[model samples]
Target chain A: MSSRNRIESVAHQTVQKSGLKNLSFRTLGAEVGVKSSSVHYHFPEKSDLGGALIQRYRQSLATTLAEIDDASPNAYDAIKLFSKLFTQECSEGKICFAGMLAAEVEFLNESNREGLQAIFNMYHTWLLDQLNQAGDELKIDLPTPTVAHLLLASLEGALLIDRAHPTNDRLSSVNILIDSWFGKIN
Target chain B: MSSRNRIESVAHQTVQKSGLKNLSFRTLGAEVGVKSSSVHYHFPEKSDLGGALIQRYRQSLATTLAEIDDASPNAYDAIKLFSKLFTQECSEGKICFAGMLAAEVEFLNESNREGLQAIFNMYHTWLLDQLNQAGDELKIDLPTPTVAHLLLASLEGALLIDRAHPTNDRLSSVNILIDSWFGKIN
Candidate 1:
């Protein structure tokens, strides 16, 4: 990877491990084997780096959702896949990068704020589309955007709770909860 | 309030505003009209203040839940009241103190971690009891701790999302979503 890509990758991991507040150009430089000035050359300010990180994450999430769309057999499977992504991150001892950043949104610069908002909007839109498709396929009354919002909130909340109390199996619990919700409609 | 209580209160507000990292003894002392040394005499380390904040928050939550239990007509009303607490905080431009702390758990001392964990446990236990009581009253099959986990997670996640996209009515959306879940059982 180029220096820019390396810095972004390391910064992402650092934010996941610690948090956005703990992320610094000096630490990021050390991880990527570059000087702090060199890191700054690529992204002049911390907010600039944060903005780029969110943009890259949005692209990655879009790619993942598209892959899930092609692979999953149904809406339930697609939802399960989405939950798994969060579960995998938590299992690795990290909250979702966006979720962590969202907790600190008030302190983020305008650029980072916009990037974070875009990522969440993307998730909401994608989840809504999936739910709409699933509602039609299963002949169920999935309440479009509202249920979409619920799904995202539930999964994100599950991850937060899981981080606090790791033994609760919240990720799988959410899967069952969602399954039961669908079961009720069927 | 006593100086210790005053210091804790200021620290709590600072953490909510800028996150745990941004909180400092000098700033907290300034807010409370005291010297940094005086603040340290009350709570020597930042983590001590963090622990105290979580402890106080848990007590406050317990008090609120007790009040809700006494006043709420049913489980649904109780849950709505519970969500209202989160909504109130968001409307005031703050995330839950514990929610913000949870995102930075890895960096917290053992005391802070324990305190945060206890607060979450208290929420889960109280939620579970309320859900169980509701299930018994309505003859619904409550899925024990899992749904409690989901409720807490969903609300916390909704607040996080709401912080990112302030225009979305996530707090009410979560209320409606939980209401719908209970409606299915009823």
Candidate 2:
């Protein structure tokens, strides 16, 4: 792989395993079989590298959501599909990187914060679109904006709980709540 | 201050600003004007210090919740009180340490994970008691376990969203949703 690719891959793993704090030149250098100086040659600062990682994560998530554009979907199915995707990601031990970074927004640089917002924006836009489509098809009253934030926030939070507790039982318990909240409307 | 208190103060700041990955004896000692060896004199291993910090955070949160008991004789008041306390902390740019550690549970030592769970257990216990009391007064039916988990998860997740987007407006938006859901329930 090119040095840039190698650096991004390494930083991604480090963030995945240890979060943003451990994304340093020394760590990336070790991971990529390069010296810290060489790592710096490709990316002048850690923030720049972080910006790239954030962008890559956003793109990857966007791509994942893009793949599931089913035709003729109703509001309930749309919500269920989103929940299924979220729960599957949690089960795989990964979650929305933007969601994770959001927990530490006070500490993030301006650029990183904007990048994180872009991820949420993408999610909200897609979600609103689905909700509109579903609401029209199902002829149901729904709280679009509130439901949008609720779905994202609750899924992110549930992932934290499930990971901390690490029980399928707990996850299923949460799914019941999600299903009830969305199911009644759909 | 005692060496234990000194180490804790430093770890608290580190956890607040940079999070657990940046938590180390050397970094924490530097924050407190001590050598890493001197810090180790107080904490034989990193886990010893981390475990203590987690305990301190739990105690502090419990103390905060204890104060709410005075204002929360009924369920409606209790829920409102809890929401106020939670939002105030988030708006002040504080991420709950247990919540943060829970995200990193997959990477944490067994001791750290235990500490995280203990925090959650304390939180859930307090919430259950408050909800049960409120339910009786308000005549609202709530599934104690499910309600406990839902409230905790939604609040934590909303903090992540508000922190991520971080407009003053986002806080109000989340508060509205909280009121709409939890407020109406009981």
Give each prediction's root-mean-square deviation over alpha carbons.
2.3, 3.8
Question: Per-residue alpha-carbon lDDT of model 2 for B35-92, expressed as tens digits?
Answer: 9999888778877777888888888888988888776656666767787777665435
lDDT tens per residue, model 1, A83-135: 77756765666788888888887778888888898988888888888887785
Please write out the lDDT profile of model 2 over residues A11-96, one tens digit for every residue. 77666555675456886798789999998887788778878988888888787777666632466666667778767644456555
TM-scores for all predictions: 0.93, 0.81
Question: Which 10 consecutive residues of model 1 chain B have the lowest summed lDDT?
Answer: B135-144
List model 1 lDDT by residue over B84-111, tens digit each.
Answer: 8756765566777777787777778877
The total number of steric clashes, by the backbone 3 Å criterion, in model 1 comes to 1
Candidate 2 contains a number of clashing pairs equal to 1
Docking class of 1: medium
Q: Cα lDDT for residue A155, model 1?
A: 82
